[model samples]
Target: MSSNTTQMSIVCISEMKNSKRVAVEEEIIGMVKLNPFLYERKHEMYKNKCMRNKKFNELGKKLNVPAQQLKARWRTLKDKFFQEFKAELIPSGSADEAVKSKWKWMERLRFLENIYTPVDNSPCSSLNISKTVQELQQNMTSLVDRAKIIAEPSVPKSAAQLFFESLAKQTEEAELTPAEFCNLQIEILKALKAASIPNYLQMFCLQQI
Candidate 1:
């Protein structure tokens, strides 16, 4: 009876977490609709900082809140939104159902994971792939270093275009919106689909007000 009760408690906790995540996501969606600038590309905000600041100031006056506070709230919401976004990418069902072969890009993931895994040098003759994990780790470190440059608070004039192009090349796709591009880039940098990157570039653009 105790074991069963403990299992039920764990399930209840998981359900509660999911429910809270859903509510937060709904709030974030509403907020984005209320302020479209909250969802705009980092490049757009960077190029039009002055105009964006004026708009924020106007909205701030009406809401009786400082523009900085509004900006900070948006950043917090954005982080939570992306966290949920990453969580949803995880496969929840059976293996066959989890394998989404319809997407060409996803088909490459298995092959890439294999390449990223290094053969082990362990004494066992069974051939372990754990030893060479360092190779992939080093590659991810390099990618993160490059991504950090683009994600810096003081981004350059053409930094957005450059980052987008790099992501497209890395993912072998194009025409992704800023959010999509950022998601893919973050996945590549971390070598996992569930890692979330700090939205410093977006926040940097927003806080310019």
Candidate 2:
């Protein structure tokens, strides 16, 4: 096989293995949820079994054999079969049904196991693409807002005076009653305060009247 093809196959196998691990973890969690007492009693046994299975599967995939093939091979061994059979035969409640459902979901998840390659090695992967795009957009928008502030032209004193004069003119032209003007001025003062601007500017503007 070509190097690229081999690399792609390895990536596929790695992803499949990860999916299987996740599925197995989910199954264990489901079993624990269904029978917390049993899980607590056999916690160490379950932990060791899961770790051994995960390691065996990962090694098998690295060697190019399917994870299921490794599991099948292990199942055929006399000792493995005896242990598994004994575990299965142990008396238990209806909790096995929940575990079965979790395994069924895992089986479905296997269908998506090879959907993407690792992000660092492959640009074509779509894993978490939407989240990446949203984060990039937010960063870009923040950068643009910062740039606008940094590039803003300084306001001349005459321009400031003219701007306020125009605002006062517009307020008068609105034909507001004395009470309405007072309310508008109060709102303007509040906005300035909220923006952390010195109150002296507002006081000066008001005093000009």
Candidate 3:
């Protein structure tokens, strides 16, 4: 029947795509082995923008995939591997058999298990946090003014919504590295989640007079 044939075709297509992803990931990991700078975190020599771009271009030509797409795919694969196991390395034994079996890319992307960047304890980091708070406070001040102006309780936006919109706008407009952008997103979510209760209280109290 057509229904059974269609299901079979879908499975075949899924398998083909998964196989292609595996090939691409393997190619990337092999290249990283040859060029450690591609994944090294603290190496000054590996931080050369020119060399990095050249390597990525080389890879793009060889794989017939855009460099940015390759980078994004690698990010996704790394996320899967890390989510499976929180350790610095994947277990080779049978303990994580379920994880290894469920996520086929686990062994292939195990090299990324230790890519955790340590927290920066420098004064500049402190200043950056202070600046972020200042910018957020400024945004909230404007939103707060709007809230005060709204006479009806049902009309004003919640503080969390305002905060998310402002922060997301900043994120979208800024030219940030992928890692920095990801960290900012995490911070944004955490701040919004923590403020949820207070946000409701603030909205409930809005123009209660």
Candidate 4:
């Protein structure tokens, strides 16, 4: 074949491949829209299968592709199909507003699931505000304990004296009450004395003070 004819043939073949890919993609999307549950179940299966196969690096080497690239493409296709299926679940506006609102909340939950850690591994698994608050309180307590260790050994006499003196001057300027002034002095003592304490506890107490 002549050079120009060969080039034309190659272009035609490439165009045909592109057209075929587009058609297949559209068909998959249509199937997902028509039967969301089917698609979702299939997607879940694929996700489980992918996770079970831990030797992705070896597989990629055999396939002559980067493992990261293969995994990324797989994830993209999986997410695309999943989203298409979810979109199908949205009812028409004519439906009851309450039903629609419920569906909207469900969709939000799905979105959050995709973005956040899975329930099994999540830090906030219980999804209870009070539980989360309790966890935070525990963490704060631990931090305080660590800080106390770090802050041990009182501040040098000279530093404590200087800090108190400075505080007294400030208290006078601000016209603070005795009680408030005493609190201020306590804070100063903690800050100056904390360095002698252990690293972990010093930070915790200093922060609270």
**Full ranking by lDDT:** 3, 1, 2, 4
Residues 1-209, candidate 2, lDDT per residue (tens digit)? Answer: 54654442432323466777545444433433453332232234544666556655665555555556544443333233233332332223534211222333334333222222123322212222212323433432332223223224594334334445555666656665443344344444444434444444434544432
Q: How far is candidate 2 from the true structure (C-alpha RMSD, Å)?
A: 26.8
- Cα miss at 160, model 4 (Å)? 54
Q: Which run of 10 residues does model 2 get worst, by summed lDDT?
A: 122-131
**lDDT at 21, model 4:** 41
Candidate with the greatest lDDT versus the true structure: 3
Provide the clash count, candidate 4: 18
* lDDT by residue (tens digit), candidate 1, 1-209: 34544322112212346665444334434544555444543234534677667756665555445666556655655544444443344343443112333432232222222212223321211222112333434443334335545545587634434544543354444444434434543333333222232334322322221
- Evaluate all candidate structures by whole-model CA lDDT and list the values in order: 0.40, 0.39, 0.51, 0.37
lDDT of 4 by residue, 1-209 (tens): 55654322212212346665444334333433443342233244445554434444554444444555445544455454344433333223444111223332234224322332223333323222212323434433433433323334574434333333443454456664333333333333233333333433433333442
Q: How many residue pairs clash in each candidate?
A: 1, 0, 0, 18
**Which residue runs does candidate 1 get wrong by more than 4 Å?**
1-38, 42-46, 93-182, 185-209
TM-score (all chains, Cα) for each model: 0.33, 0.24, 0.42, 0.25
lDDT of 3 by residue, 17-109 (tens): 867867878887677667767776656666798988788778877776777766676667655555564422222344522234456666765
Error of 4 at 122 (Å): 7.0
By summed lDDT, which 10 consecutive residues of candidate 4 come out lowest?
6-15
How well does candidate 1 match the true structure in TM-score terms? 0.33
Score residue 43 of candidate 1 by CA lDDT: 30
Off by over 4 Å in 4: 1-54, 93-125, 129-209
